[model samples]
Target: MTTASTARRPRGRSPLHGGRFGLLAVLPFIAFMLLFAVYPLTQVVRMALSHVEIQNGAFIWDFGTLANFARMFDDALAMSSAVTTAVFIAATVPLTLVLGTLLAVLVDRSALFGPIARNIALWPAVVAPVVVSLIWLLILSPTVGVLNRVLIDVGLPPQGWLGSEAGAMLSIILVDVWHWTPVVFLLVYTALKGIDDQLLEAARVDGATERQIFWRIVLPLLAPALAAAALIRLVMGVKAFDEMYLLTRGGPGDATTLVSLHIRNVFFDRLELGYGAAFSLAVVLFVIVVLLVSVVVRRTVRQGGAAA
Candidate 1:
């Protein structure tokens, strides 16, 4: 009787055992964030709130001041940079989305040339932004540029693509669109591939026109992917520094001077570390707000899609 009761006894795990194992599994990631992300952010906050100076190869910090942040209100260049960033985002994001989705649809419908076209479209995304900037810089050069040469040969005058305010802004916007559109295309194309063929077939069987099927059936399914792509592009646009920095260096009377470039100038050119840190924090706050809005938008899209 004793042996039978012992054999039938329930076996249970201590609650702490699983918890410990889970913590152990995530320990490396936590350590990585602490060492790389959190620590640096703390330093940035410290710098932002202090007056920094270097003397005799040593650093000094005079804490307890909001002067750096307060100066932002009077900083005309910084305000202009913000406006330029806004313009850049407004132009690049929509163009990238529309062109990318169109290309994805074209590739999806093209049975014979789909694979080849997909590979070609993905080529620009694989290239580094710095390299893309350099390549475009050469192509947009007023003297000896292939584009200008073609224009000259066709009885058109050469234009200074980066020499004027409008031209520089437009050139950067176009380059950015060219560089990032491929990313959106890949995302939308993958989403397209995941769509059920039977759903489309059923729509056709119901006598729905191709346009109607695309607008009513296909687009609704693709909403989540579109929202995700837009979020990614918006964030990337906000932080975009490489191409603009390398290609134009915020030139043509500050027309292409984005916030990122402005922050860089504060840190290096002006050697205003404290001010730069404060500016960077403001940008971080902006990014966080953008992320929050994106989350809300994505959730709403998902809920709407489920309802449909």
Candidate 2:
């Protein structure tokens, strides 16, 4: 039966109207994103493919090829830098999550200082990563650094912070935690705010302790937000470059070199633009995979909870 006419729309407004409105609303954002983000990204990729040959005291792009990737494999410093970057991400991601959660919980509980405390917590995130790195570099400097001076005054031995290979990655991690933890805290705190007070009241009335309510009710509800925060941090952590560069320039022995830094060095320093582009694309693909896996894990957790 041809029921196309009978299945008539009950809409008061045309479908195209809504789409038009949406398009209008999003046009500025799309234009801005394209101009600032996409255009630059495309330029980088293009430059990466272009051949860079040293001539007349400047690197000149001759043509494009996969020569950069081939050279990257043989470049020991590049490979080592990539490894160091991965290690930094692994070390910092978990710490960021934990500290973020703790700060979020504290901020949510404050009756008087919530706004003040939240702003303070968010301060580090607002500070430019490069500036933060520079500040820390001074604070952690081996000679005449305030940190070491304080340690000496406290009768503790002063230790080299970003100056040595052994402590450089840790210093970077600390800087990362200081800067990025607020991002997670804000997300988790927002999720916590959306939770129903009635459910918490019910749990309290049911003789559930505070810890029990948090673990059983609050945590499960906030899992998705936590997962999202972790995914974001994971991506950011893996691609960390600005702070690391300012803090250590990959340091005394390639200690804090991350993938982004390696890519920068390949593209700009070594003039292997094509290889750098490939490496950057690899980072993007890795981030996409991580996000996909995180989404799957969150779904799996929801399904398991439902099953139980």
Candidate 3:
């Protein structure tokens, strides 16, 4: 019996053996982070705490003050940039989510056009942001532009899409929405595909109307994906610079001056490297905090849904 049992025993590697290989695989990633991410982040922190000046073509760092950070409180441009950033986020994130979700549902349900629509929706995301901005710039230009020409042909007055304060902000917000809504659609559509059809069939059998089934079953199932999309767009919105910079250059009159643009201006335009570093650090911290809060909220939501 002992001999039979010994022969029947299956041989397999222990988890520790697999874990060692996993560790070895991750060593390169760890080294890369230390070399790139950690090193640069340390340098940023050092610069943030110092008073940096260029003397004789070399940077002189006086590492003894919090004036850079303190100046943030009194800087009017910084305050304005913060408000602009907030408004940008508020305007873009929700529109992106709602439009994305709606598009995703429409595409998912349309059998004949689903594949075509999916491919077309991904086009904006694949195009470079700078290229997108350039295309929109021509479209929104005041004179000799396609949009203005169209408006004139329609017997409507041509408006300055990017030449007024409200127009610039609205234009940038619309551009951001156009660019990112596709990404959110991709996320929500993928989630929609993963949903089991049996649940819907069962709901239909139970006399649930199409709208009721969607609102009751499909939307709940899509909650996590929606949350994930929102978080991604939130982070992207916070760091948005390229489109606004290319389209309006944070104008007209600082209307589209996001925090990232403000930081860039401080660093390169004003040559206030230390203050920019401090501001950059603060933005990084804010992003981190937002990420943490989003994670907590998502978890709570998931738990609450499960409980319900």
Best by TM-score: 3
lDDT of each residue in 74-175, candidate 3, tens digit only: 999999999999999999999999999999999999999999999999899989999999999889999967999999999999999999999999999999
Model 3 alpha-carbon drift over 4 Å, by segment: 1-20, 304-308
RMSD of 1: 2.9
Q: lDDT: which candidate is best?
A: 3
Residues 52-156 of candidate 2 have per-residue lDDT tens digits of 566798867766576655776787877897688778878788898889998998899898999999889988999987789778877898887889999999999
My TM-score estimates for the predictions, one after another, are: 0.92, 0.82, 0.93
Q: What value does the lDDT take at residue 8 in candidate 2?
A: 82
Off by over 4 Å in 1: 1-17, 300-308
Model 3, position 143, has a per-residue lDDT of: 91
Q: Given candidate 1, what's the lDDT at residue 14?
A: 50
lDDT of 1 by residue, 143-233 (tens): 9678899999999999999999899999999999999999999999999999999999998999999999999988878887888898899
Candidate 2 collision pairs:
48-273, 48-274, 51-63
Candidate 3: deviation at residue 286, Å? 0.5
In order of TM-score, best first, we have: 3, 1, 2
